[model samples]
Target chain A: MGKALAAAIGLASIAAAVTAPTAFGQPPPGAAACSGCHPASARVTSPVVRLAGLERDAIVRAMQGFRSGQRAGTVMDRIAKGFTDDEIQALAAWFAAQPKGGEEGNPARVPLPKGGEEGNPARVPLPKK
Target chain B: MTFTRRRFLGLAGCTALFPAPARGQGAGPRVVVVGGGFGGASCARALRQLDPRVSVTLVEASATFTACPFSNAVIGGLRELSAQQFTYARVAADGITLVPAMATAVDPAAKSVTLADGTRLPYDRLVLAPGIDIRWGALPGYDEAAAALMPHAWKAGEQTLLLRRQLEAMNDGGLVVIAAPANPFRCPPGPYERASLIAHYLKTKKPKSKLIVLDAKDAFSKQRLFQAAWAELYPGLLEWVPLSKGGAVTSVDAATRTLVTDFGKHQANVASVIPPQKAGRIAEAAGVTDRTGWCPIDPVTFESTLQRGIHVVGDAAIAGAMPKSAFAANSQAKSCAAAVVTLLAGGTPAAPKLINTCYSLVAPDYGISVAGVYAPSGGQLADVPGAGGVSPANAPRATRAAEAVLAEAWFHTITGEVFG
Candidate 1:
């Protein structure tokens, strides 16, 4: 089902790409919200797909597919329906400019503490049953 | 820069005769943010990212922030409390001055905040991300003292452990009761998620035990999905009572672990009463909250409608269509930060695009979600037509498993972005 939907949306994008206009400027109004789920860096291990550095056309196509119910998604379909074509184009342009991969020695990256490990004092011990 | 009389007059209920302190030559505008949860921390970082010139200071009472999102997993015995805790060490390293002190008062007329230790910090723009504070005594017999006996694990710290311990210590056939509150509460789906996880624990550890949810609301977020999951995954072990069926808890007796409704009184061996909530006390002291006990704000910029030069995000804000969730708070903080930056630069902020997506787990591998995309419409936030809804009912287990993975990923990515 997923493959068939992707192929169908692929064909639809080819036709839409011919008329799509390039959008650029300060990041559009809603662009920052996407990073809540889609990580900015490739090194961030997330099941949600990363959006940085993707082809603008690809982002536009995926959004259109989600909006039109041609693509299967848990939440993206609902979110995609909220954006207009212009807004999507603007967001696509902004995300395409970001780095697709993580910086090697980025001091900003902080490792998250692992959950459920035994013998770690920070982990709250389970009550004796 | 001179303080303008017009700006002074714009401040509501101001009686101060003194002017705001002048900045040094070529100094950037100063911004003060209170509370270091998802909202304030995100805004503090976003401000530095948007404009390096703005001098930002964050005032938080605690050295570490305990996130409420995954704290439920801790209560359910699936995760650890340490995983939900984060420090602002990296946030401070990102050019923000961290003031580790409690904000005791806010003088809007003077545009300064007074800390508990007699320190006053002034700012050109102030952001209050004070999350919800339980309205003790609103429901008779449910107060701070009662919380010690019947824990309300809503704030996600010691209370979380208290409730977890109670559940673990109960005998095999003990009855567990969760009293859920009415509308406009933080994490609309939280009580249900807690119920689901606790039910999972009871089923595994104490097969003879039973759990009951007495909800104040007749309907709830992700109702269809949650009810379906409960029926399938925990048939005889759990029961949910809605408002129409006498679920609204009017009062409680902590000493007896008894919850009273209009219809009858129910007693339990382990009780979790999530009392009614209001905007954090700091918001009230700041004079930004309305009669609804929540702060009203301009949907586009999240600036408090009741007080100029102050913005309120997170659970405290009266966001029209947005539920009080960590994801929504993070989104609002970023937008508010961008607007504050623009205003400081003497430019108009563009209309904001706000979004919220909340993921809840019924079991370790069974997850569900609800999402919405909102924009300012008719002077308030409204959901765009044809957009946003919950996960489909009766989905294949693979779909649920996939969402469960994504839910964990969401936690990692968001916490990393704000704190890491």
Candidate 2:
């Protein structure tokens, strides 16, 4: 039984290393922070728009707009001025490659436990006027 | 006690219930995370997500975590305590071992954590996200017992409800006093937000009551925005006393509900004295804390400067220029997780870029925020030039309402990420 357990553990480790999800590529330095406010999960309803699966050019254009004060945002303008053009390009490309469904996104989304909805106000839709 | 075929099958079935990939039950580097708040929980989950081969264990004292982000809303009667409460069922379901026991001691040399129940958890890396603990005797006449009479409500659970009940039970024309702490505390803008929400509660529920904020700092985060909203929404109801104006509370008399400042002593019907704070007790026990009572870390990796193999994140860490807010904590945790993964694989971790956005609601519909991008510089984290600042002063009402909605959204999205 002990030998069997050892073999199973060894096989699992090898499988994990071989199937590691680095195939999706690593995210840029500051890219993970964007999902703090922007919903990575389609299941999460928020006023902030999700950046996953956006056109790389579109994301770059919006960031440039915020940086140059051409676009108006409550917080994005301040945040955009922090990144260089190269960093922005890298982030845009990384986010654009993420799956829109959110499973294979920058900030990986996990399945909530049963009745976890009660703690997540974002899951509820905002009231319409 | 002999192993039978049926027994072997049952064992296999149990192992099948937890997939080996997610659980990292294979031979790999082990990580043990203490404290299940935004920092610790995010790190534990991020470690698993980053490399499923790494075994992760989260040791939290409580079954449920009460988040401090929206806890002020609870004190203002704008939210329920249940909305701020979350369980670790999802974190456990992700296959990390969840230990619901207080971590008592750390043997850094041995790389093991001793729990209150006498179980020792061995680990290759230890991440301490213990958050902040109130400095009990730092303020004269304010200790654990004094908290019963004059609640701080800083730590969020029972104290949050206590302060709310005090506000609810106060007389219609009563006075509410909030004593704000000095620099380098958890949530730089929290005291002001608490003051705003308490004023909102007073305006709607007890029209004749008044609130005064005794600030230990002359200026605070988003100061102009908060002051502007106070003038427009709560002109006569709320008053702010800056430190230069003798606003610093020197001591407290809980029984009499009196706050003594350098100028004079003021008695209030309800007193919320936010005392001095330091890193949580566990960090000190682990011998990672410095003279500042906070752990100093390598800004890029969050590895303790004083201790090897132990990383500190969240409010317990002295992250330069980054306010000790939940958003910053979560961001730091992710960076720490990434660095830990690389280090375990015998690779050098790259410099990390981090961000923090903190929203303060002046009213249920009026909100303001400060955002910043940060990177490692000069051996500490520094704000990226021209990248972050407070909300524009004198913005239109529509903008304020929009920010308020976004503030709620930020809360939901962040809490969902960390706890959901």
Candidate 3:
């Protein structure tokens, strides 16, 4: 019964996750919560483009750039390909409405298990000549 | 699974069972596709879109899909995991029979597949796109239990959510360790993408938190591209230990959260072990594992040489010069679908051209890729010269940024093609 219950819960979460509302169909508050890393603050001089100051239209335009091969050979094309037109707008709106440094919404990390370890490691063999 | 006009008729006969007739009409040949990731979804959907006569049934273990392709952006906070999801409804809406069941075994001789629930699904042509499977015990001390404590999150589902939750909940200044398996696995650039995204989160959310990558390969899929991005964009926050430096993890004690390496033992606050992979177990059980853990297929037909009537595509079938990528799987699925359709239409499979270009996002504006177009030569698929290859290592920064955007667009287009 315990195993069955656990499996039930596992399956339930699996279902919930697949249908999670925060990000799949529309950009939820979560998308807005990541602007601190690359905000387009006037003082912010990241070589990376900042999405914070961009409007919904611009962000969508940027994503579309990747899609039509205009922004050729870029990963943005791959990322942009993941959403529907409606969902893309939601993401753009959610992010565009935010100010620079608007980061939040990260949950706490579950402690690593006593036996949990890296699948493969590479930093230890004596350095090869 | 001999192709016949009668089999196609039977497929048409089942549509009467649906409330609404699918987008296509008539009985086509019978095609059973297992797994709904890029490959299964693509093959099944393509069969219907390319040729309406074929009856396509897709058996996916889950109703909804959490794509591995861009889950990294979810990790980075640049994109939501929801954006990386699709429903089997798209496949169903496209008139493919979408079955939510795990494919357990295949009887190639009988041309039938046994589902986990003991349903026997017979087919004229069986397409197995169950993706790659983790050889669990390949790394000692790591088992399913250990995964709970430290998630591999390789298959892309709730653990993806769980990993995201853990990343969220970790205290600022915390340490997150990512252990990447050696090459020839699903989504070659996934680990680096994960690290970059995770570091992006840590840099902002935790401030002092760090992302440590313990990689098993000598160098990564796009080492220079990733290194340049990490240095200029995420310096001091992301660190990588390559295989040459003892980054190859030999074993793990999930209970102890300790990883044993040739160098020594070190523990982390969080660990994700993506083990060495093989063709999904059904393929192995169906007699597909060669000296390598993958099946070598005739690129033209994607037929399993070891067995008749079964074709393996995606990460299961080995195609040279093609990384085991989502784009490759989707492309392979289309070719497989075309071949199956041609044979069903009372014709021989055509000599096919397969195309794939995988995008890895470093930042929203930064991306890199490897593109290839393949044709059969000397019993194997070879990249057509000047058609596809890795993005130039020394591309201008702006160009790299452009590729990142294109990568996202490609993801949208390809996934739409499959599950849209």
Clashes of each: 0, 0, 67
Residue A37 in candidate 1 has what lDDT? 89
lDDT by residue for model 1 over B47-149, one digit each (tens)? 9888777789999989888889978888899887777888888899888999999898998868899999989999878999999999999999999888987
Cα lDDT listed for each candidate? 0.83, 0.83, 0.68
Task: List the per-model TM-score of the A chain.
Answer: 0.59, 0.59, 0.46
Q: How accurately is candidate 2 docked according to DockQ?
A: 0.19
Better of 1 and 2 by TM-score: 1
Q: After superposition, how far is residue B312 of candidate 1 from its true place, in Å?
A: 0.7
The order of the candidates by lDDT, greatest first, is 2, 1, 3
Give a tens-digit lDDT track for model 2, residues A24-118.
Answer: 24466777788788876555666678899999999999999999999988899999998777677777887888888543221223333445223
| Model 2: per-residue Cα lDDT over B195-285, one tens digit each | 9999999999998999999988899988889998999989899999999999999999887889999999989988899999999999999
Question: Please, what are the lDDT tens digits per residue for candidate 3 over residues B1-420?
Answer: 354535643553443333333433555457898888888887786688656756788988887777888877765666555667676654687788888888888887677889998999888788888788888788787777777777788877656766776676677777788889987887788898888888777777787877778889987777787898899889999889988999889988876567878998767766777778888888887776697889988876788777665788898888876778887787677678766665554444545555566678877777777655555655676654434446676778888777776665566555544554
Winner by TM-score between candidate 3 and candidate 1: 1
Q: What docking tier does model 1 reach?
A: acceptable
Off by over 4 Å in 3: A1-129, B1-28, B394-397
User: B365 in model 2: Cα distance from truth in Å?
Assistant: 0.5
Weakest lDDT window of 10 consecutive positions for candidate 1 chain B: B11-20
Runs off by more than 4 Å, candidate 2: A1-25, A102-129, B1-25
